[model samples]
Target: MSSVETVKNSPWQQGARDALPLLGGYIPVAISFGLIAVQSGFSALETVLISALIYAGASQFLFIAMVASGAPLWLVLVMTLLINARHLVYGPNIAPYLSNSRWWPVLMHGLTDQIFALAHTRLPQLEEKDRMGWYISAALIAWLSWIVGTAVGAVAGAEITSRWPLLGEVMPFALPALFLVLLAPRFTSVQWTLTMLVSIVAALVLKLMGMTNSAIPLAALCGVSLFYLLQAKLKAEGEIHG
Candidate 1:
């Protein structure tokens, strides 16, 4: 067989290589999560466990904030579920592309926002049978990188924070900065622009109303719904005019 075929058949090798670009982004944020968690009073073990179990950078930061502040369990539960609700949207979109392997469920564990973005954008280029293997390989690499980065940060975070308090203060901003970087590309579209405006307003309002943790999900839900509504309205208007 050809070299491309040989490499493609070994999904793990292909995926690991594909996943490298994402590391420039993922490693720093994962490390920041670990650093922030420990500085926020989490034990290194607890911090590592949070990354291992939660596996979501934004939600993990939110969880650390809530737990450090001693927020109510009910509030934390509500916030966590709401914040992760976007995954519900992600799963259905990806389901059709995935193979019917029994390991599908396990593979799905690696479905993060970034991975999903990568999958939808990149997977279409691959042969159908090879897509799942590549996706699973990419996912596993990303997941492992996150865990390792978290472990590194957890072990060294507290000491680093103590040595350079400014760095600790800066750790919390890393996730938000990363998100802004991700969102920048989408800002060119009118639909995305409107959605961002509405989301920003909603988040600010929620924060003012003392529902800080609830802001992210609520804003996202509002923005997505508004985008769909606007799109439908424009489509209907075009049809009538046509």
Candidate 2:
């Protein structure tokens, strides 16, 4: 490619292009969320604002559900924080590739589970100077798609669902399907497989026990903690054997 072409189709542009597949998942799920929020008595504007401001997929659904159920704001806040605490791990893992960019704190707003997964895989292969641009591009596209999807859902979700009831049922699966797509490639070892199986079992058990609200976060914590503990054990055994 010519230098001009390269500049025109920069890493930023590539990132946005790479994020296009996310729209298929993000839009439908976001629309579902918008519909649910609106049906739950939130105004269309509030629905859009929630997607724009919070942008925390499943957590937003949980937030709306909690609010509708008259859960206290403090409890809602705690649950939201607990669900998103995985970001602490995500941010640090991606920070090295950011090359100490001053805009990181601001850019971090765009971080999401899918974005983190994509960045973890792609960033290391990018030129140092291109990493931030690519990240910003991918994040921006994903964010905008979500906001637009929410708006559509807030405005017309009921109509859409009423016309195609099956869509309403299927929309909920989009998020989980997207997650499986993102994580499937990483199940490259016994450890990863075991961690995922454990997490799945934990989540299922929690849900069966009527701890649905805590299942996701607790299960995620269980998986991550187990992976780390396994890693530590392996390192110790390797040192002793060496």
Candidate 3:
């Protein structure tokens, strides 16, 4: 490659290095997905395909769980889409930084929660010309780590289950545990705490009201709306007092 190409590619390497910490966090959660997928009667191939194609960690867990329980196909599709609707918010936030590259579609395909979180916080610090390369590189590292972790988990799942059935039963909880771990640090903020509480209550109430699969989407909508309203209200009160 020419020196020009090398200059263009350097940001990709930098992005990979920056995302190294995320890889440590991703591996165990992805391994759990693979293990649970196989335990839910998916072939190793099917498990990997779901991880590769769908690539939504939380939704994937919900997908396999619902499918295992014999939920209708339409419901499964709707639920997965509902669970991932939050990505719409992430997309617009990152769009201006995409560098208008021809390869954006490929990069966007793998934009997960962790990728978005990192990109939103770090991209502005990057040189304008390097933002796309860094974003893509970081996202690719995370994607590959998930896929590799899933493969390892799928391969080892059978032996582990055979030897210790209870441990296999515990695998599905990993997704929830992972979320708790991620959210723990953020709970120091009142807004985040309120959002979490609102979402949980709304989801539970909607579920009790016979909304079933629709509960999550509706609840998330309510929580986000309430959060914004609260923020606006606070701002208004502060202005009045000031």
Best by lDDT: 2
What is the C-alpha lDDT profile of model 2 across 47-123, one tens digit per residue?
99999999898789989999999999999999888877767888988877778767888998999988887788778
> How do these models rank on TM-score, best leading?
2, 1, 3
Report the C-alpha displacement of residue 143, candidate 3, in angstroms.
0.6
Give one digit per residue, the lDDT tens place, for model 1 in 125-209: 5767888778878998888888988987788755654676664455546445545554565677888899998998898899999
Scanning candidate 3 in windows of ten residues, the lowest lDDT window is 1-10
Candidate 3 versus truth, CA RMSD in Å, comes to 7.3
Error of 2 at 146 (Å): 1.3
- For TM-score, candidate 2 versus 3, the one ahead is 2
Instruction: Evaluate all candidate structures by whole-model CA lDDT and list the values in order.
Output: 0.76, 0.84, 0.77
Deviation in angstroms for 185 in model 2? 4.9
Q: lDDT value for candidate 3? A: 0.77
Query: Candidate 1's error at 240, in angstroms?
Result: 5.9
Off by over 4 Å in 2: 1-9, 166-188, 200-213, 224-242
Q: With candidate 1 superimposed using the best TM-score fit, by how many Å does residue 67's alpha carbon deviate from the native?
A: 1.8
Please report how far candidate 3 places residue 33 from its true position, in Å.
Answer: 1.4
